[model samples]
Target: MAQDRAQKNRPHYALASVDHALRLAVMLQVEGPLSVSDAAERLGVARSTAHRLLSMLVYRDFARQGEDRRYHAGPVISLTADSQSRTALLRTVALPHLHALVGRLGESANLLVLAGDYARFIGSVESSQALRVGNREGMVFPAHLTSGGKLILADLTPAEREELYAAQRWDGREGERPDPAALEQELAVVRDRGFAINKDRTETGVTAVGRGVRVGDRVGAAVTVSMPTVRFDESRLVDIVSALALASRDIEHDLQAALRVEA
Candidate 1:
């Protein structure tokens, strides 16, 4: 009864149309670009309503219509007084999707970005199982050893990759540095398959599948689902790959939008 009273006493004031319009603005800001139909589906509003809302946002300079006819976050949002860093923005935009992926696949999910010769985990959502991989945020792994890092590496041309490999300073550990020919072969598979997998590569008994997140034809980051080798099943690889691909699209959309806003 006291909880009911507390709930009733809580202040509430919201304008439905305005609230939805603001949400649409946020979606544009975080999810990159959207058409009226996409906004309608995401916002759960009628198409006409979504169109009206977008039009108003465009007028206010809070969103802009691109040459592709998709709606993008406008000057007002980018020029806002908020001092949030790009890294923070990326984490904010990616965390929810990572959580959703974890919920769907019952596996740990991560967002990683290329940092020099390493792939750095910037965000992670851990699985609920007792034996699952723990949080890896802020951790860095050699680019060649990690699925996410390999996907980013595969984005480079053969000559470019060769140049990078030649310039790399490797540790004395045996097999730490990848053979140029073998690495190129692996990259070819990654390109053809549109994803990369690491089985007992980064760590023994751990497996990870990763897909690159592209922003304007460049791989800016990667999204991955990781699990223990004991729990991993090759038969379910298709399902995991599909989930990672979907999440990658969402992240890429947000990344492209963010880059445009920054520009």
Candidate 2:
């Protein structure tokens, strides 16, 4: 009897239904209100399957059906989108700088800021190289493991900095992650250096350099250039530093200008 019950429970783990429901929600999220046929076409599923998935989404507040019978992501998703919009505005202002840096350096340039306890990529520009390190916008990486993350985090107050690491995961390799006291010491060095360097901290072959974007006393964001370690040797350190500092100043000026326009 126990074996039979286990067999019955195994079917619940299939999750095909869950995948369809999530796809329906994402379709509604990106494409706005979608008819059953429209969603089915996007997901390459049968119309009946799409309708069933959307019904489940409605039950979970992930989507809603209007009087026109089109499904839209519900209020819960709208609130999240509103928050993302604020970040999107910052990314828009920083994109030109990021692109210019990538064009000049011939590497991947990323714009990042603190998001909760992690560093979130808000924008990125890549060189024309066939092989490159690319970043997905809005992807979050651990704060202690990236140059841009360290540059931004170093600007936070000591108390705020402690709060940031309280829940952080120290999954970095040996010697890369240290206790609270050690992190404080490292941050001090980063502050003095005016630029942060990550030597294979995030990935084995990736090296990155970053400078903070300061708006008056506060750091609004950071800009980073990521390249393969072989390409980022000490010979290029001076040039990288000069390029990043120039980019940082440009970003700060842009931020201040946007603030004036807003005011």
Candidate 3:
């Protein structure tokens, strides 16, 4: 009966195409580059089918093709390797600051880091209020959809942002995928204001404010406060931003100290 219940809880169907693509993605991450024939042989699929799968991966920035006709992990995947250790360290150093933000703002606070084209919640401190937002650690959301993501994206140069968006494959759902032109404009506002705000953008009735946490010239992470729209007050945004900025600086200081220790 326990086994049966577990089976019932699992997804009933799996798309072969999706499974194939996922397998290929894992291989690319773990084993590095591969050619079409290599992927076909490994997956036991036809070369033509492998090419189609690879094309989708390339379109999504999960993989890239080189002049030698070999496919390696793309910018997103490469960034993952570059940022993984830093992200782990940031999470450890930012936890106390996140808690402090929650105490000051009475709203849930999170530490997010960029992982490829998504923002990953690395640490969080829930608000004390009964109706407050809950912890979101381990959640991954598209970078363009969340305030934290937008804040980090705003740090990238226009050309870098465009390159990141060029091969994206958009979902059919409205607002699931960002329009490049619109995103460009929104990022401009983020840069000018030194922060980003999302009101009912990522989720209905949810609002978030975020600012980038920098390690020198680069944005290393983002600090965010989230609350229900009903509790959101535009008048308090400035104060909230102030609290977050202070918390970011605190985290940044600790991160620098930690790096110096390692050095």
Candidate 4:
């Protein structure tokens, strides 16, 4: 839901290039294939600037150039790994566990990483049930408003928090920002509980539970299980949290083994 709102306020002191890149990425995600000229027009940048940005995106696997010369969502959008970038590796390692989680819980699950102020879902597995949460790969959500996002936010230090969410940064988007004191209290609860649950915080009729995946000292990603709110059972929270933890551990173990092999 990166483009969930149509008229989000521009951040104060926002870098034009970075903003353009992120917006272009979202456009590719939400609107499908786009020509360079169209990208330039959408971003209001010179064609050369758009081309350069598209080149960078191609290099990072965020986009792929088709034979038609249009840019489209790349393998990264589908969580395919070329075994080069760490993000790809993360998705590769996490997917098996995500599928296992879906099998165990009968709910869709996703692996997400912190991307600037948003949480980007890098891998996702949908449940087989006729009525279930759908795939959410390649989507971004405000970090403060998602279960996985809150876990990533809780991992940040106070100074890091200030640096990322400083008032000046949200100048035009003040209405969308979380209350500082409330956010601190919520993060405290997230840290203390070792997991997070969002009951329709980002989307109505959906609920998600998340646990952090740690890579040595830093939390690298979050493993989350999402389901329709009608099926949510608070009484089953403990069991769901346990399954998420097991999946997280499996992913971490694989990541470590992969690193050792690389070393």
In order, candidate lDDTs are 0.79, 0.73, 0.80, 0.83
TM-scores of all predicted structures:
0.64, 0.68, 0.67, 0.72
Per-residue lDDT tens digits of candidate 3, residues 1-263? 32122111113495868868876775565346789999998667999999999999999998999999998877766535545456657777898888889889999999887766778777778899988776666566778878899988999888878776764443443334467898899898999999898777656577889999997678868999999889999899899999999998999899999988877
Per-residue lDDT of 190-246 in model 2, one digit per residue for the tens?
999998998776565678889998855787678899887777788888888898999
Query: Candidate order by lDDT, highest to lowest?
Result: 4, 3, 1, 2
Error of 4 at 160 (Å): 0.5
Candidate 1's residue-wise lDDT over 141-207, tens digit each?
8787788999999997777677666734544532455677878888889989999998876666788
User: Model 3: runs farther than 4 Å from truth?
Assistant: 1-83, 168-175
Model 2 CA deviation exceeding 4 Å by range: 1-85, 167-178
Candidate 3: how many backbone clashes?
Answer: 0
Per-residue lDDT of model 4, residues 95-182, tens digit only: 8999999999999999988988989887788999998987677677888888898998999999998888888998887777777888
Which of the numbered candidates is closest to the native, going by highest TM-score?
A: 4
Model 1 residue pairs with clashes: none
The residue pairs that clash in candidate 4, if any, are none
TM-score of 2: 0.68
Question: Worst ten-residue run, lDDT, model 1?
Answer: 2-11
Counting only residues 3 or more apart in sequence or on different chains, how many pairs clash (N, Cα, C under 3 Å) in candidate 2?
A: 0
